[model samples]
Target: MINVVGFRYCRLGTADLEETVKFGTDMIGLETVGRENGSVYMRGDDRDHNICYFEGDPTDHTLGLELADFDALDAAESTLTTAGLDVHRGTGEEATARRCMGYINFKDPSGNSIDLTVRPFAAGRRYFPGRDAGIDEFSHIGLRVTDPREAEKFWSEVFNFKTSDWIGWSALMTFDEVHHRFALFPSDRPGIQHINFQVSETDDVMRSNYFLRDHQVRIQAGPGRHSLSGARFLYFYGPDEMIYEYSCGVRMVDDTWRARQFPVNDASFCAWGSKPDLSVLEGPDAAE
Candidate 1:
Protein backbone atom coordinates (compact mmCIF):
# COMPACT_ATOMS: atom_id res chain seq x y z
CA MET A 1 0.00 0.00 0.00
CA ILE A 2 1.18 3.54 -0.73
CA ASN A 3 1.68 5.43 2.51
CA VAL A 4 -0.23 8.56 1.60
CA VAL A 5 0.05 11.30 4.21
CA GLY A 6 -2.43 14.07 3.33
CA PHE A 7 -3.80 16.28 0.59
CA ARG A 8 -1.47 19.05 -0.50
CA TYR A 9 -2.91 21.24 -3.25
CA CYS A 10 -5.14 21.38 -6.31
CA ARG A 11 -4.32 22.64 -9.81
CA LEU A 12 -7.18 23.58 -12.07
CA GLY A 13 -7.26 24.89 -15.63
CA THR A 14 -9.33 27.99 -16.30
CA ALA A 15 -10.23 29.72 -19.57
CA ASP A 16 -10.06 33.13 -17.91
CA LEU A 17 -7.19 33.09 -15.42
CA GLU A 18 -7.82 36.61 -14.17
CA GLU A 19 -11.51 35.96 -13.60
CA THR A 20 -10.72 32.85 -11.59
CA VAL A 21 -8.13 34.81 -9.61
CA LYS A 22 -10.66 37.48 -8.84
CA PHE A 23 -13.24 34.88 -7.83
CA GLY A 24 -10.72 33.16 -5.56
CA THR A 25 -9.51 36.35 -3.87
CA ASP A 26 -12.57 38.56 -3.87
CA MET A 27 -15.26 35.90 -3.44
CA ILE A 28 -13.71 32.81 -1.87
CA GLY A 29 -11.43 34.87 0.42
CA LEU A 30 -8.20 33.16 -0.59
CA GLU A 31 -5.02 35.23 -0.47
CA THR A 32 -3.27 35.64 -3.80
CA VAL A 33 0.35 34.69 -3.20
CA GLY A 34 1.96 34.49 -6.62
CA ARG A 35 1.24 35.11 -10.29
CA GLU A 36 3.64 33.98 -12.96
CA ASN A 37 3.51 32.82 -16.55
CA GLY A 38 -0.13 31.75 -16.96
CA SER A 39 -0.82 30.54 -13.43
CA VAL A 40 -2.15 32.30 -10.32
CA TYR A 41 -1.41 30.79 -6.88
CA MET A 42 -3.70 31.32 -3.92
CA ARG A 43 -3.49 30.25 -0.27
CA GLY A 44 -5.91 29.69 2.58
CA ASP A 45 -3.34 28.86 5.23
CA ASP A 46 0.44 28.64 5.79
CA ARG A 47 0.87 26.32 2.81
CA ASP A 48 2.82 27.90 -0.05
CA HIS A 49 -0.36 27.52 -2.08
CA ASN A 50 -3.55 25.55 -1.75
CA ILE A 51 -5.01 26.25 -5.18
CA CYS A 52 -3.64 27.18 -8.59
CA TYR A 53 -5.58 28.43 -11.59
CA PHE A 54 -3.70 28.20 -14.87
CA GLU A 55 -4.62 29.00 -18.45
CA GLY A 56 -5.80 25.80 -20.09
CA ASP A 57 -8.92 23.75 -20.75
CA PRO A 58 -11.47 24.02 -17.94
CA THR A 59 -11.69 20.21 -17.85
CA ASP A 60 -8.10 19.88 -16.64
CA HIS A 61 -7.72 19.24 -12.89
CA THR A 62 -5.00 17.80 -10.71
CA LEU A 63 -5.11 16.89 -7.01
CA GLY A 64 -1.83 16.61 -5.14
CA LEU A 65 -0.99 14.41 -2.16
CA GLU A 66 2.04 14.92 0.07
CA LEU A 67 4.20 11.96 1.02
CA ALA A 68 6.46 11.66 4.05
CA ASP A 69 9.79 12.00 2.22
CA PHE A 70 11.71 11.07 -0.88
CA ASP A 71 11.77 7.43 0.15
CA ALA A 72 8.01 7.38 0.58
CA LEU A 73 7.52 9.03 -2.78
CA ASP A 74 9.79 6.44 -4.38
CA ALA A 75 7.86 3.65 -2.69
CA ALA A 76 4.60 5.09 -4.02
CA GLU A 77 5.87 5.20 -7.58
CA SER A 78 7.14 1.62 -7.35
CA THR A 79 3.86 0.46 -5.88
CA LEU A 80 1.75 2.10 -8.56
CA THR A 81 3.98 0.79 -11.35
CA THR A 82 3.93 -2.72 -9.89
CA ALA A 83 0.15 -2.56 -9.79
CA GLY A 84 0.15 -1.94 -13.56
CA LEU A 85 -0.59 1.75 -13.38
CA ASP A 86 1.40 4.23 -15.43
CA VAL A 87 3.27 6.73 -13.26
CA HIS A 88 5.15 9.69 -14.67
CA ARG A 89 7.90 11.40 -12.70
CA GLY A 90 7.72 15.17 -12.74
CA THR A 91 10.55 17.01 -14.49
CA GLY A 92 12.74 19.55 -12.71
CA GLU A 93 10.82 22.39 -14.32
CA GLU A 94 7.51 20.82 -13.36
CA ALA A 95 8.66 20.37 -9.77
CA THR A 96 9.69 24.01 -9.62
CA ALA A 97 6.32 25.04 -11.04
CA ARG A 98 4.47 23.04 -8.35
CA ARG A 99 6.75 24.39 -5.57
CA CYS A 100 7.77 20.89 -4.62
CA MET A 101 11.09 19.06 -4.49
CA GLY A 102 9.79 16.08 -6.45
CA TYR A 103 6.50 14.59 -7.62
CA ILE A 104 4.97 11.78 -9.65
CA ASN A 105 1.77 12.04 -11.62
CA PHE A 106 -0.80 9.30 -12.22
CA LYS A 107 -4.52 8.80 -12.51
CA ASP A 108 -6.76 7.30 -9.87
CA PRO A 109 -9.10 4.45 -10.75
CA SER A 110 -11.75 7.07 -11.43
CA GLY A 111 -9.39 8.95 -13.79
CA ASN A 112 -8.83 12.04 -11.62
CA SER A 113 -5.25 13.28 -11.97
CA ILE A 114 -3.22 12.50 -8.88
CA ASP A 115 0.14 14.05 -8.03
CA LEU A 116 2.12 12.41 -5.26
CA THR A 117 4.58 15.06 -4.16
CA VAL A 118 7.58 15.24 -1.86
CA ARG A 119 8.50 18.28 0.23
CA PRO A 120 5.70 20.66 -0.69
CA PHE A 121 6.67 24.17 0.43
CA ALA A 122 4.95 26.14 3.16
CA ALA A 123 4.84 29.89 3.68
CA GLY A 124 6.85 31.51 6.46
CA ARG A 125 4.16 34.10 7.11
CA ARG A 126 0.52 33.73 8.13
CA TYR A 127 -2.24 33.87 5.55
CA PHE A 128 -4.26 37.06 5.12
CA PRO A 129 -7.54 36.67 3.26
CA GLY A 130 -8.87 39.33 0.88
CA ARG A 131 -12.22 38.95 2.58
CA ASP A 132 -13.03 37.62 6.06
CA ALA A 133 -14.62 34.21 5.30
CA GLY A 134 -12.97 32.91 8.47
CA ILE A 135 -11.37 30.06 6.53
CA ASP A 136 -9.28 27.83 8.75
CA GLU A 137 -7.91 25.39 6.20
CA PHE A 138 -8.42 23.78 2.79
CA SER A 139 -10.26 20.81 4.17
CA HIS A 140 -11.40 18.05 1.81
CA ILE A 141 -12.63 17.29 -1.70
CA GLY A 142 -15.55 15.44 -3.26
CA LEU A 143 -14.68 13.35 -6.31
CA ARG A 144 -17.24 12.12 -8.82
CA VAL A 145 -16.90 8.45 -9.74
CA THR A 146 -18.72 6.22 -12.17
CA ASP A 147 -18.67 3.28 -9.77
CA PRO A 148 -18.33 4.11 -6.10
CA ARG A 149 -17.83 0.50 -5.02
CA GLU A 150 -14.87 -0.03 -7.29
CA ALA A 151 -13.51 3.44 -6.54
CA GLU A 152 -13.81 2.86 -2.79
CA LYS A 153 -11.99 -0.45 -3.09
CA PHE A 154 -9.22 1.12 -5.17
CA TRP A 155 -8.60 3.94 -2.68
CA SER A 156 -8.70 1.60 0.30
CA GLU A 157 -6.52 -1.14 -1.18
CA VAL A 158 -4.01 1.11 -2.93
CA PHE A 159 -3.57 4.08 -0.59
CA ASN A 160 -5.10 2.55 2.56
CA PHE A 161 -7.65 5.34 2.88
CA LYS A 162 -10.09 4.27 5.59
CA THR A 163 -13.80 4.53 5.09
CA SER A 164 -15.44 6.73 7.73
CA ASP A 165 -19.01 6.54 6.43
CA TRP A 166 -21.11 5.81 3.37
CA ILE A 167 -24.20 7.54 2.14
CA GLY A 168 -25.52 5.37 -0.67
CA TRP A 169 -22.76 5.10 -3.28
CA SER A 170 -20.90 8.04 -1.74
CA ALA A 171 -18.00 6.99 0.45
CA LEU A 172 -16.41 9.30 3.02
CA MET A 173 -12.75 8.40 3.47
CA THR A 174 -9.85 9.59 5.58
CA PHE A 175 -6.05 9.40 5.42
CA ASP A 176 -5.53 10.55 9.00
CA GLU A 177 -7.49 11.56 12.12
CA VAL A 178 -9.78 14.05 10.41
CA HIS A 179 -13.07 12.31 9.66
CA HIS A 180 -12.75 12.48 5.87
CA ARG A 181 -10.21 14.06 3.59
CA PHE A 182 -11.69 12.55 0.42
CA ALA A 183 -15.19 11.56 -0.62
CA LEU A 184 -16.45 9.71 -3.68
CA PHE A 185 -19.90 10.44 -5.09
CA PRO A 186 -21.60 8.49 -7.85
CA SER A 187 -21.65 10.21 -11.22
CA ASP A 188 -21.40 9.46 -14.92
CA ARG A 189 -18.29 11.59 -15.38
CA PRO A 190 -15.03 11.99 -13.51
CA GLY A 191 -14.07 15.37 -12.00
CA ILE A 192 -14.00 17.27 -8.77
CA GLN A 193 -17.52 17.42 -7.37
CA HIS A 194 -16.64 20.12 -4.88
CA ILE A 195 -13.67 21.65 -3.03
CA ASN A 196 -14.23 22.35 0.65
CA PHE A 197 -12.64 24.82 3.05
CA GLN A 198 -13.33 24.63 6.75
CA VAL A 199 -14.30 27.82 8.48
CA SER A 200 -13.72 28.85 12.11
CA GLU A 201 -17.26 28.31 13.30
CA THR A 202 -20.97 28.26 12.50
CA ASP A 203 -20.87 32.04 12.55
CA ASP A 204 -18.46 31.96 9.65
CA VAL A 205 -20.90 29.84 7.66
CA MET A 206 -23.71 32.29 8.38
CA ARG A 207 -21.54 35.27 7.53
CA SER A 208 -20.46 33.74 4.23
CA ASN A 209 -24.09 33.04 3.33
CA TYR A 210 -24.99 36.71 3.56
CA PHE A 211 -21.68 37.81 2.14
CA LEU A 212 -21.98 35.58 -0.95
CA ARG A 213 -25.62 36.54 -1.38
CA ASP A 214 -24.77 40.23 -1.20
CA HIS A 215 -22.13 39.75 -3.88
CA GLN A 216 -24.66 37.92 -6.10
CA VAL A 217 -22.56 34.77 -6.21
CA ARG A 218 -24.98 31.90 -6.90
CA ILE A 219 -25.55 29.90 -3.73
CA GLN A 220 -25.82 26.28 -4.75
CA ALA A 221 -26.57 24.64 -1.39
CA GLY A 222 -26.17 24.54 2.37
CA PRO A 223 -26.46 26.98 5.24
CA GLY A 224 -27.42 23.62 6.79
CA ARG A 225 -25.77 20.95 8.90
CA HIS A 226 -24.66 17.70 7.28
CA SER A 227 -25.79 14.49 8.89
CA LEU A 228 -22.78 12.55 7.64
CA SER A 229 -19.90 14.69 9.00
CA GLY A 230 -21.89 16.92 11.35
CA ALA A 231 -20.53 20.00 9.60
CA ARG A 232 -22.45 23.20 8.91
CA PHE A 233 -21.82 24.09 5.30
CA LEU A 234 -22.56 26.35 2.35
CA TYR A 235 -21.85 25.45 -1.31
CA PHE A 236 -21.57 27.90 -4.16
CA TYR A 237 -20.44 28.05 -7.79
CA GLY A 238 -17.23 29.68 -8.94
CA PRO A 239 -15.34 30.31 -12.16
CA ASP A 240 -15.10 27.49 -14.71
CA GLU A 241 -18.24 25.98 -13.15
CA MET A 242 -16.27 24.71 -10.16
CA ILE A 243 -18.07 24.26 -6.87
CA TYR A 244 -16.62 25.74 -3.66
CA GLU A 245 -17.73 24.94 -0.15
CA TYR A 246 -17.42 26.59 3.27
CA SER A 247 -17.99 24.28 6.21
CA CYS A 248 -17.33 24.12 9.94
CA GLY A 249 -17.76 21.83 12.97
CA VAL A 250 -16.87 18.57 11.23
CA ARG A 251 -16.70 15.55 13.49
CA MET A 252 -13.37 13.84 14.04
CA VAL A 253 -12.71 10.11 14.33
CA ASP A 254 -9.84 8.16 15.78
CA ASP A 255 -8.73 4.53 15.92
CA THR A 256 -11.67 3.64 18.10
CA TRP A 257 -14.30 5.01 15.76
CA ARG A 258 -16.28 2.56 13.67
CA ALA A 259 -17.36 3.25 10.12
CA ARG A 260 -21.09 3.61 9.50
CA GLN A 261 -23.29 3.36 6.43
CA PHE A 262 -26.44 5.23 5.48
CA PRO A 263 -28.89 4.92 2.65
CA VAL A 264 -28.50 7.51 -0.12
CA ASN A 265 -31.21 10.07 0.38
CA ASP A 266 -31.79 13.70 1.31
CA ALA A 267 -31.90 12.90 5.05
CA SER A 268 -28.47 11.30 4.92
CA PHE A 269 -27.06 14.46 3.33
CA CYS A 270 -28.65 17.14 5.50
CA ALA A 271 -30.39 16.80 8.86
CA TRP A 272 -31.46 20.45 9.04
CA GLY A 273 -34.15 20.23 6.34
CA SER A 274 -32.14 22.10 3.67
CA LYS A 275 -31.86 20.35 0.32
CA PRO A 276 -28.52 20.65 -1.38
CA ASP A 277 -28.66 21.52 -5.07
CA LEU A 278 -28.69 17.89 -6.24
CA SER A 279 -26.92 18.87 -9.41
CA VAL A 280 -23.89 19.70 -7.34
CA LEU A 281 -23.93 16.28 -5.70
CA GLU A 282 -25.04 14.01 -8.57
CA GLY A 283 -23.99 16.12 -11.58
CA PRO A 284 -26.11 18.07 -14.12
CA ASP A 285 -28.98 15.61 -14.52
CA ALA A 286 -30.60 16.40 -11.17
CA ALA A 287 -30.64 20.06 -12.03
CA GLU A 288 -32.66 19.50 -15.19
Candidate 2:
Protein backbone atom coordinates (compact mmCIF):
# COMPACT_ATOMS: atom_id res chain seq x y z
CA MET A 1 0.00 0.00 0.00
CA ILE A 2 1.09 3.62 -0.61
CA ASN A 3 0.65 4.64 3.07
CA VAL A 4 -0.85 8.02 2.45
CA VAL A 5 -0.83 10.27 5.49
CA GLY A 6 -3.61 12.59 4.33
CA PHE A 7 -4.94 14.77 1.56
CA ARG A 8 -2.63 17.66 0.83
CA TYR A 9 -4.14 19.98 -1.78
CA CYS A 10 -5.96 20.25 -5.07
CA ARG A 11 -4.93 21.93 -8.31
CA LEU A 12 -7.78 23.09 -10.51
CA GLY A 13 -7.50 24.43 -14.04
CA THR A 14 -9.71 27.34 -14.99
CA ALA A 15 -10.30 29.33 -18.13
CA ASP A 16 -10.69 32.50 -16.05
CA LEU A 17 -7.97 32.40 -13.43
CA GLU A 18 -8.75 35.84 -12.05
CA GLU A 19 -12.42 35.03 -11.65
CA THR A 20 -11.63 31.78 -9.94
CA VAL A 21 -9.27 33.57 -7.58
CA LYS A 22 -11.98 36.12 -6.76
CA PHE A 23 -14.50 33.36 -6.05
CA GLY A 24 -11.98 31.46 -3.93
CA THR A 25 -11.06 34.48 -1.82
CA ASP A 26 -14.31 36.41 -1.81
CA MET A 27 -16.91 33.69 -1.91
CA ILE A 28 -15.11 30.73 -0.37
CA GLY A 29 -13.12 32.72 2.22
CA LEU A 30 -9.71 31.21 1.42
CA GLU A 31 -6.61 33.27 2.12
CA THR A 32 -4.61 34.18 -0.95
CA VAL A 33 -1.08 32.98 -0.26
CA GLY A 34 0.86 33.41 -3.53
CA ARG A 35 0.67 33.83 -7.26
CA GLU A 36 3.17 32.66 -9.88
CA ASN A 37 3.29 31.51 -13.46
CA GLY A 38 -0.40 32.04 -14.15
CA SER A 39 -1.52 30.25 -11.00
CA VAL A 40 -3.01 31.63 -7.77
CA TYR A 41 -2.48 29.74 -4.51
CA MET A 42 -5.06 29.97 -1.72
CA ARG A 43 -5.15 28.49 1.75
CA GLY A 44 -7.73 27.73 4.42
CA ASP A 45 -5.19 26.71 7.02
CA ASP A 46 -1.45 26.87 7.79
CA ARG A 47 -0.42 24.82 4.77
CA ASP A 48 1.10 26.93 2.02
CA HIS A 49 -2.00 26.34 -0.11
CA ASN A 50 -5.00 24.09 -0.13
CA ILE A 51 -6.16 24.99 -3.60
CA CYS A 52 -4.54 26.33 -6.77
CA TYR A 53 -6.33 27.89 -9.73
CA PHE A 54 -4.39 27.99 -12.98
CA GLU A 55 -5.19 28.98 -16.55
CA GLY A 56 -6.04 25.89 -18.51
CA ASP A 57 -8.91 23.57 -19.44
CA PRO A 58 -11.48 23.52 -16.63
CA THR A 59 -11.58 19.73 -16.78
CA ASP A 60 -7.96 19.49 -15.71
CA HIS A 61 -7.95 18.90 -11.96
CA THR A 62 -5.30 17.26 -9.80
CA LEU A 63 -5.79 16.01 -6.24
CA GLY A 64 -2.65 15.75 -4.10
CA LEU A 65 -1.90 13.18 -1.39
CA GLU A 66 0.93 13.47 1.11
CA LEU A 67 3.17 10.48 1.76
CA ALA A 68 5.37 10.11 4.82
CA ASP A 69 8.69 10.52 2.97
CA PHE A 70 10.62 9.92 -0.20
CA ASP A 71 10.80 6.19 0.57
CA ALA A 72 7.02 5.93 0.78
CA LEU A 73 6.70 7.93 -2.43
CA ASP A 74 9.17 5.61 -4.12
CA ALA A 75 7.25 2.59 -2.89
CA ALA A 76 4.01 4.08 -4.28
CA GLU A 77 5.57 4.64 -7.69
CA SER A 78 6.95 1.11 -7.78
CA THR A 79 3.66 -0.36 -6.62
CA LEU A 80 1.62 1.51 -9.21
CA THR A 81 4.07 0.71 -12.01
CA THR A 82 4.00 -2.96 -11.06
CA ALA A 83 0.23 -2.83 -11.25
CA GLY A 84 0.57 -1.60 -14.88
CA LEU A 85 -0.20 2.05 -14.25
CA ASP A 86 1.93 4.83 -15.73
CA VAL A 87 3.49 7.03 -13.09
CA HIS A 88 5.47 10.20 -13.83
CA ARG A 89 7.98 11.63 -11.39
CA GLY A 90 7.73 15.36 -10.92
CA THR A 91 10.65 17.46 -12.10
CA GLY A 92 12.40 20.01 -9.88
CA GLU A 93 10.57 22.84 -11.63
CA GLU A 94 7.26 21.04 -11.19
CA ALA A 95 7.98 20.41 -7.52
CA THR A 96 8.92 24.06 -7.06
CA ALA A 97 5.69 25.18 -8.74
CA ARG A 98 3.68 23.04 -6.31
CA ARG A 99 5.85 24.17 -3.35
CA CYS A 100 6.59 20.56 -2.54
CA MET A 101 10.01 18.94 -2.16
CA GLY A 102 9.08 16.10 -4.51
CA TYR A 103 6.04 14.48 -6.14
CA ILE A 104 4.83 11.91 -8.63
CA ASN A 105 1.75 12.17 -10.84
CA PHE A 106 -0.59 9.51 -12.14
CA LYS A 107 -4.21 8.91 -13.10
CA ASP A 108 -6.56 6.69 -11.17
CA PRO A 109 -8.80 4.01 -12.70
CA SER A 110 -11.46 6.70 -13.18
CA GLY A 111 -8.94 8.99 -14.95
CA ASN A 112 -8.81 11.55 -12.17
CA SER A 113 -5.33 13.06 -11.85
CA ILE A 114 -3.54 12.42 -8.56
CA ASP A 115 -0.18 13.50 -7.17
CA LEU A 116 1.68 11.81 -4.36
CA THR A 117 4.19 14.17 -2.82
CA VAL A 118 6.89 14.24 -0.13
CA ARG A 119 7.58 17.13 2.26
CA PRO A 120 4.66 19.30 1.23
CA PHE A 121 5.33 22.90 2.29
CA ALA A 122 3.35 24.94 4.83
CA ALA A 123 3.55 28.58 5.82
CA GLY A 124 4.98 29.52 9.22
CA ARG A 125 2.39 32.26 9.54
CA ARG A 126 -1.23 31.63 10.46
CA TYR A 127 -4.05 31.74 7.95
CA PHE A 128 -6.19 34.85 7.69
CA PRO A 129 -9.31 34.52 5.55
CA GLY A 130 -10.31 37.03 2.89
CA ARG A 131 -13.80 36.89 4.36
CA ASP A 132 -15.56 35.40 7.39
CA ALA A 133 -16.76 32.18 5.84
CA GLY A 134 -15.72 30.53 9.08
CA ILE A 135 -13.54 27.99 7.34
CA ASP A 136 -11.41 25.73 9.49
CA GLU A 137 -9.46 23.84 6.81
CA PHE A 138 -9.70 22.14 3.50
CA SER A 139 -11.41 18.85 4.20
CA HIS A 140 -12.66 15.92 2.12
CA ILE A 141 -13.37 15.84 -1.63
CA GLY A 142 -16.15 14.12 -3.55
CA LEU A 143 -14.75 12.31 -6.59
CA ARG A 144 -16.99 11.50 -9.55
CA VAL A 145 -16.21 8.06 -10.85
CA THR A 146 -17.53 5.98 -13.72
CA ASP A 147 -17.06 2.85 -11.64
CA PRO A 148 -17.26 3.33 -7.89
CA ARG A 149 -16.32 -0.26 -7.13
CA GLU A 150 -13.18 -0.14 -9.25
CA ALA A 151 -12.27 3.28 -7.88
CA GLU A 152 -12.88 2.15 -4.28
CA LYS A 153 -10.75 -0.95 -4.75
CA PHE A 154 -7.90 1.08 -6.26
CA TRP A 155 -7.94 3.56 -3.37
CA SER A 156 -8.28 0.87 -0.70
CA GLU A 157 -5.60 -1.45 -2.14
CA VAL A 158 -3.13 1.22 -3.19
CA PHE A 159 -3.44 3.94 -0.58
CA ASN A 160 -5.00 1.86 2.22
CA PHE A 161 -7.99 4.19 2.57
CA LYS A 162 -10.64 2.57 4.77
CA THR A 163 -14.36 2.85 4.26
CA SER A 164 -16.06 4.72 7.05
CA ASP A 165 -19.54 4.04 5.67
CA TRP A 166 -21.48 3.71 2.45
CA ILE A 167 -24.53 5.59 1.17
CA GLY A 168 -25.66 3.37 -1.66
CA TRP A 169 -22.61 2.81 -3.87
CA SER A 170 -20.93 6.00 -2.69
CA ALA A 171 -18.07 5.25 -0.33
CA LEU A 172 -17.10 7.63 2.45
CA MET A 173 -13.43 6.82 3.07
CA THR A 174 -10.79 7.99 5.51
CA PHE A 175 -7.03 7.81 5.88
CA ASP A 176 -6.78 9.09 9.44
CA GLU A 177 -9.49 9.62 12.09
CA VAL A 178 -11.34 12.28 10.15
CA HIS A 179 -14.64 10.79 8.97
CA HIS A 180 -13.82 10.95 5.28
CA ARG A 181 -10.93 12.45 3.42
CA PHE A 182 -12.31 11.24 0.12
CA ALA A 183 -15.63 10.04 -1.28
CA LEU A 184 -16.40 8.22 -4.51
CA PHE A 185 -19.70 8.91 -6.34
CA PRO A 186 -20.77 7.28 -9.57
CA SER A 187 -20.92 9.58 -12.58
CA ASP A 188 -20.81 9.44 -16.35
CA ARG A 189 -17.52 11.33 -16.44
CA PRO A 190 -14.60 11.80 -14.10
CA GLY A 191 -13.93 15.02 -12.18
CA ILE A 192 -14.33 16.46 -8.71
CA GLN A 193 -17.92 16.40 -7.57
CA HIS A 194 -17.24 18.85 -4.78
CA ILE A 195 -14.43 20.27 -2.62
CA ASN A 196 -15.35 20.53 1.06
CA PHE A 197 -13.98 22.67 3.85
CA GLN A 198 -14.79 22.14 7.49
CA VAL A 199 -16.16 25.25 9.13
CA SER A 200 -16.28 26.28 12.79
CA GLU A 201 -19.85 25.10 13.52
CA THR A 202 -23.45 24.80 12.32
CA ASP A 203 -23.67 28.59 12.65
CA ASP A 204 -20.81 28.86 10.19
CA VAL A 205 -22.74 26.81 7.69
CA MET A 206 -25.85 29.00 8.10
CA ARG A 207 -23.80 32.21 7.93
CA SER A 208 -22.21 31.12 4.66
CA ASN A 209 -25.62 30.22 3.30
CA TYR A 210 -26.87 33.76 3.84
CA PHE A 211 -23.56 35.24 2.75
CA LEU A 212 -23.63 33.27 -0.47
CA ARG A 213 -27.28 34.18 -1.09
CA ASP A 214 -26.53 37.90 -0.71
CA HIS A 215 -23.45 37.58 -2.90
CA GLN A 216 -25.60 35.85 -5.56
CA VAL A 217 -23.49 32.71 -5.47
CA ARG A 218 -25.60 29.74 -6.52
CA ILE A 219 -26.49 27.55 -3.57
CA GLN A 220 -26.44 23.92 -4.68
CA ALA A 221 -27.61 22.17 -1.51
CA GLY A 222 -27.58 21.89 2.26
CA PRO A 223 -27.93 24.09 5.33
CA GLY A 224 -28.99 20.62 6.45
CA ARG A 225 -27.29 17.84 8.36
CA HIS A 226 -25.94 14.81 6.56
CA SER A 227 -27.16 11.43 7.80
CA LEU A 228 -23.82 9.71 7.16
CA SER A 229 -21.16 12.02 8.64
CA GLY A 230 -23.60 13.96 10.85
CA ALA A 231 -22.19 17.18 9.47
CA ARG A 232 -24.18 20.35 8.86
CA PHE A 233 -23.40 21.55 5.33
CA LEU A 234 -23.88 24.10 2.59
CA TYR A 235 -22.99 23.40 -1.03
CA PHE A 236 -22.53 26.29 -3.40
CA TYR A 237 -21.24 26.83 -6.90
CA GLY A 238 -18.05 28.73 -7.60
CA PRO A 239 -16.36 29.82 -10.80
CA ASP A 240 -16.28 27.35 -13.69
CA GLU A 241 -19.23 25.53 -12.09
CA MET A 242 -16.96 23.96 -9.49
CA ILE A 243 -18.89 22.89 -6.39
CA TYR A 244 -17.59 23.98 -3.01
CA GLU A 245 -18.93 23.00 0.38
CA TYR A 246 -18.80 24.31 3.95
CA SER A 247 -19.56 21.86 6.71
CA CYS A 248 -18.94 21.15 10.39
CA GLY A 249 -19.47 18.53 13.10
CA VAL A 250 -18.19 15.54 11.20
CA ARG A 251 -18.03 12.27 13.12
CA MET A 252 -14.60 10.76 13.69
CA VAL A 253 -14.31 6.99 13.49
CA ASP A 254 -11.97 4.76 15.46
CA ASP A 255 -10.48 1.30 14.86
CA THR A 256 -13.40 -0.22 16.75
CA TRP A 257 -15.94 1.42 14.44
CA ARG A 258 -17.34 -0.93 11.85
CA ALA A 259 -18.33 0.38 8.42
CA ARG A 260 -22.03 0.30 7.62
CA GLN A 261 -23.92 0.47 4.32
CA PHE A 262 -27.12 2.37 3.61
CA PRO A 263 -29.32 2.37 0.56
CA VAL A 264 -28.93 5.28 -1.84
CA ASN A 265 -31.78 7.58 -0.95
CA ASP A 266 -32.65 11.06 0.27
CA ALA A 267 -32.62 9.83 3.86
CA SER A 268 -29.08 8.53 3.50
CA PHE A 269 -27.88 11.85 2.08
CA CYS A 270 -29.55 14.34 4.40
CA ALA A 271 -31.22 14.04 7.77
CA TRP A 272 -32.94 17.43 7.48
CA GLY A 273 -34.44 16.76 4.01
CA SER A 274 -32.59 19.33 1.90
CA LYS A 275 -32.04 17.87 -1.57
CA PRO A 276 -29.05 18.38 -3.79
CA ASP A 277 -29.26 18.37 -7.58
CA LEU A 278 -27.13 15.28 -7.81
CA SER A 279 -27.98 13.76 -11.17
CA VAL A 280 -25.08 11.37 -10.72
CA LEU A 281 -26.91 9.44 -8.02
CA GLU A 282 -30.33 9.19 -9.66
CA GLY A 283 -30.73 6.47 -12.24
CA PRO A 284 -31.34 2.75 -11.80
CA ASP A 285 -27.94 2.43 -13.45
CA ALA A 286 -26.39 4.30 -10.51
CA ALA A 287 -23.52 2.66 -8.64
CA GLU A 288 -24.22 -0.53 -6.73
How many residue pairs collide in each prediction?
A: 0, 0
> Candidate 1: TM-score?
0.96
TM-score per prediction, in order, is 0.96, 0.97
- Tens-digit lDDT track of model 1 for 28-75: 999999989889999888899999889999889899889999999889
Model 1, which residues run further than 4 Å from truth? 279-288
Every candidate's CA RMSD: 2.6, 1.3
Please list the C-alpha lDDT of all candidates, in the order they appear. 0.88, 0.89
- Top candidate by lDDT: 2
Clashing pairs in 1: none
Distance from true position, residue 212, model 1, in Å?
Answer: 0.6
- Report the lDDT tens digits of candidate 2 across residue range 1-288: 889886889999998998888888888999999999999999998888999889999989999989999999889999999999999999999999888999999999989999999999979999999998888999999998888888888989987899999877888999999989988888887888899999999999998898899989998887889898999999888888899999999999999889999877777888999886656565236444
RMSD of 1: 2.6
